[model samples]
Target chain A: MSGHGLVLRNICKKFGSTNVIRNLSLNVIPGEFLTLLGPSGCGKSTLLRIIAGLELQDEGSIAIGGREVDGLRPKLRDVAMVFQSYALYPHMSVAKNLAIPLLMRRLCAWQRIPVFGALLPGTASRKSEIIEEVARVAKSIGISHLLDRKPRQLSGGQRQRVAVGRAMVRHPAVFLMDEPLSNLDAKLRVQMRAEIKELHQRLGVTFIYVTHDQVEAMTLSDRVAVMLDGELVQVAPPQEIYANPHDRRVAEFVGSPKINMIDVNVCGGRLAEIGGQVLPSELTIGQGTLTVGIRPEAFHLASSGEPNSISAAVRLVEHMGSDLFLHLDLTGVPDPIIARLPAASGHIAPGNRLHLRIRTEQLLLFSENGQRLKQQASVTPLREYAR
Target chain B: MKHCRLSFRTLGRHGFLAITTAFVIVPFIWMVSLSLKPPEEIFQASFSLLPQSWHATQNYIRAMTASPLPRFMLNGVFICAVIVVFQILICAPIAYALAKLRFPGRHVFFNLVLVSLLIPSQVLALPLFILAYQLGLLNTYAALVFPFVVSPLGIFLFRQFFNTISDDIVHAARLDGMSEFTIVWRIMLPMAVPALIAFSIFSVVGHWNDLFWPLIAVRSQELMPPPLGLMAFKNEDTGIDYGPLMAGSTIVVAPLVLVFLLAQRWFIEGLTSGGIK
Candidate 1:
């Protein structure tokens, strides 16, 4: 089935006096896997709850498939959610838990009686149909053998799959998941992440997944909406968010080991003075202090006398299987500068001097207030020198 | 040396338990002995653990034949069962709302429940009697069952139990198209079996042995519960017969003891765990 698009307009929410969501608007195209990525208590889960009709937004309108659903209850919204705790009915067997939704929606009050329902003419057929559907969904999720078992009898990963299977049975136009994999062990989390991605592709439904994990957002989502303190910072593809971030907070929050910050003085419009050395820049900024952010991988090791290089003492070295991260202590910089390099790029010990080179295009300049500055066209290349 | 100390500790524990067990079981043994003894030996001036002259069959026969004792027991069973079932139906939803739903004056209502728990039921007997009389409900099952159908204790117990359940499950049920009524009865009631069993024991025992309310509100012989019926049997002009009286008491107390024996595991677990939170 083709999935339907979702549109949320000017959603505002408050818990007591604090505004948890501030006029947030989002649009999800049909059959797109969009992840809302944020830290804990950033209101991402609350937003998902609002869309599912579990919580009513204070001031907003939600439309699913072009129909406004402002006052509709969750069941009428045609959207299903998989909770973080896997919220399975503990007293029911797996098959019963999966069949409850269909039973409630399909059967009338007279047809739900235990003995009489079986005796009713069409009730028997509907009952068998529900069982068959439950079994089919269970088999698809590799939980066919667990149909008779209760929720407590399953492992964490198995319970998570049952929760997803329950959501899938409804075949709703939209699927909302709130950290559905946070309870698993590390290895199982990675495995379930891949399975969820595959499930999205198979169903081709509009998926709104909420998570605080950047890696899950990066790997699974077609677009990641980064949130901080209840406001959307940026919404873009994962690579664009990583490589070209609009806000300094987005850049810092998205990357591991964190992007490095260096305070430099801009001289005229084409040069930046850093630690008693002049570096050429293509940016035209006012003559003042600006914060420069550079990724760890942007720095590379150079010969001791290489031009346009900064020399500093190595403070520590962390050796990963595929990469080496060196912490360097420069004379004027307040924090240690970290550089990631290939693991086989020669031995580097602490207390040894190291020279690193950074490309002009790789340097990201931000003002003191954390707004990124655009670079202008270059007139000439600056001379190379070592310090 | 350590092995010797361990055995000594074990012996001491068993000795203490033995003493406590005798303290609790001696009264029941005495009651059974009295029920089996003849009238002449019941007040004998000797310390006897067992009946010297066995009149068990005659005493039981007289107890049943004397004054509609079995009918009184049937009434007791019907009344307690109705009260307990109605209490669960009325209390479970209130408890669920008090624990999960956020509405206006929720805290005030909960505080009122706490305050009601402090007021003894005996203090309200006079007002309840007046209300029953005005409604023309005295001497009927309505008077006997109405005041007890809404038990503050049951509501508090169920609220505490429901609080332990995760809210996500309730939300999940709502999203699955179940209404609040369905969530309370179908979903929560099943998960609260232990608490229900424990509350059942408390409700059944409390109403079964109650003499004050039934004496005040129910005056007809046919409407009297076990305790009042037994009292009526003992105070007959034929004078008090100790053997028959004890036998009747045993008959009245038997059902609750049997129920407790059958469900002691869930009862004990519910009491201990419900108290912890």
Candidate 2:
């Protein structure tokens, strides 16, 4: 089957008085796995439901496979969803659950009666065909043995697989998953994440996955759309989103331990000063106040008499197996500067004095209103350094 | 000394339970014993747990032959069954909508149901009797069954039960291409087995033993339910036959007890499961 692309244009949704999704537009390419990553109550799940036709947007148009599907029901839209709760029928066997969509679409009303249907002509063969298809899907997902068991008898992970299997059996053009792995334990979540990635690869169907977990978005998505407060802040590949975020909220929301912010003064169109120390820079912006964002990994231990080095006292050090995060109290800085270094870098203790250095290329500059400021390519030093 | 005190508390609790159990069970035992006794042995001053003479077969035969008792029982079964089936059909959908769907005046409708529940059936008996007479439905099955077809208790019980089910399951059914009709009957109905069972018990028992409505609505012997027929047997113009009256009472009460015994497990399970959830 050919995979279909989805386009959601200018979608705006309001719940009573609160605007949940505000003029949001996104285009998902065919056979690509796109993730909408955001915090809880950020309207990501509402957007997915709107695409599936489970909820109608207050103002917007949605097109699946080049056809507008604004008024179509979920089943008619050819989209299947794997919910966060799995939402399996607790009383039916796994096989019956998987066969429901197919049966509903294919069989007539009279042909669906439990015992009488078998007595009708051509029903026996059709039912066998459905059973065969269900078996094939079950075997592919490695849940063939669970076909006879009810949902209550299965573990969380098994039920998750069965849910996925149910969605796959329909062969829908698009698969929408809403936090499908949040119910599983930590270890099982990782395993299921890989399985979902594999399934997308095997089927080559367009997937629009919504999740609040950053790691899931980073590890599984070909492109991640970062949303904040019901608006699309940034949409790019994971590495670009982490490094070259268009908005400050995207930068702060994606990374662990958060990117550190320090206010710096740009002097004479080239020079930058932090904490009363004039630092070397290649910036050509006019004299103004700028906020500098520095990742913890960008800080390195200063060599003896190294240029652009700042002295600070270590307040705390957190050992995280392969890396050590040092909380340093820099002079004239209100908040502690956190630096991530190699675990075997040196013998460091609390209450010790140390020097740290950062390269100019690793520093990001933002205007007072949290907008990124482009930097000039030419290198220029302060007048003191020129002397 | 501590062990002794604990044993003393256990004994006191068990003793209290034993007294209550006897108080409830003694009347039933006395009824059965009286039904088994001959006419002379029933009035003796001395009380005994078992009848002095075994006249169970004779009494049962006379009760069956006396005043169309079997026909009355059949009417009772037919009326109760029809009433229960209609009640489920009428209540389940309204209950589902009230519990899950949003609409204007939903709360007002539910409040009306609650208020209707507080107003006992006896209060409506006169108006209902007049309406039945106007419709020419008296002395018919419609008169016996129509008043209870829409049960406020059934709707209330089913609404509470349906509220306990997660809405996600209903959404999943919709995504699976099921119409609302199929979702209610196929999905919600099967999931509501316990509630349905409990409702069936309540409806059957209430309508089966009811003497008030049938007494006012029905005038012909053919339309008399078991309770009305039993009353007729007691107050026959010939005389009061205590032995046959007791026998007929036993027959009238046996079916309800048998039904409870058969569905006792499901009855308790349905009530407790809905409560815990």
Q: What is the interface RMSD of candidate 1, in Å?
A: 0.6
The residue-by-residue lDDT of candidate 2 on B1-277, one tens digit each, is: 9999999999999999999999998888888888898888888999886788888888888899968999999999999999999999999999899988878999999999989999989999999999999999988999999999999988988888888888778878888888887788888879989888988999999999999999999989999999999888777821556677788889999999999999998887777765644
Candidate 2, A293-337: lDDT as tens digits:
778887888875555577879999999989999998987778998
| Index of the highest-DockQ prediction | 1
What's the lDDT for residue B232 in model 1?
91
Per-prediction share of native contacts kept: 0.76, 0.61
What are the clash counts of all predictions, listed in order? 1, 0
Candidate 1 local lDDT, A187-296, one digit each (tens): 99999999999999999999999999999999999999999898998999999888888888888898877898888877775577554346656665658788778898
iRMS, model 2 (angstroms)? 0.9
Between which residue pairs do clashes occur in model 2?
A: none
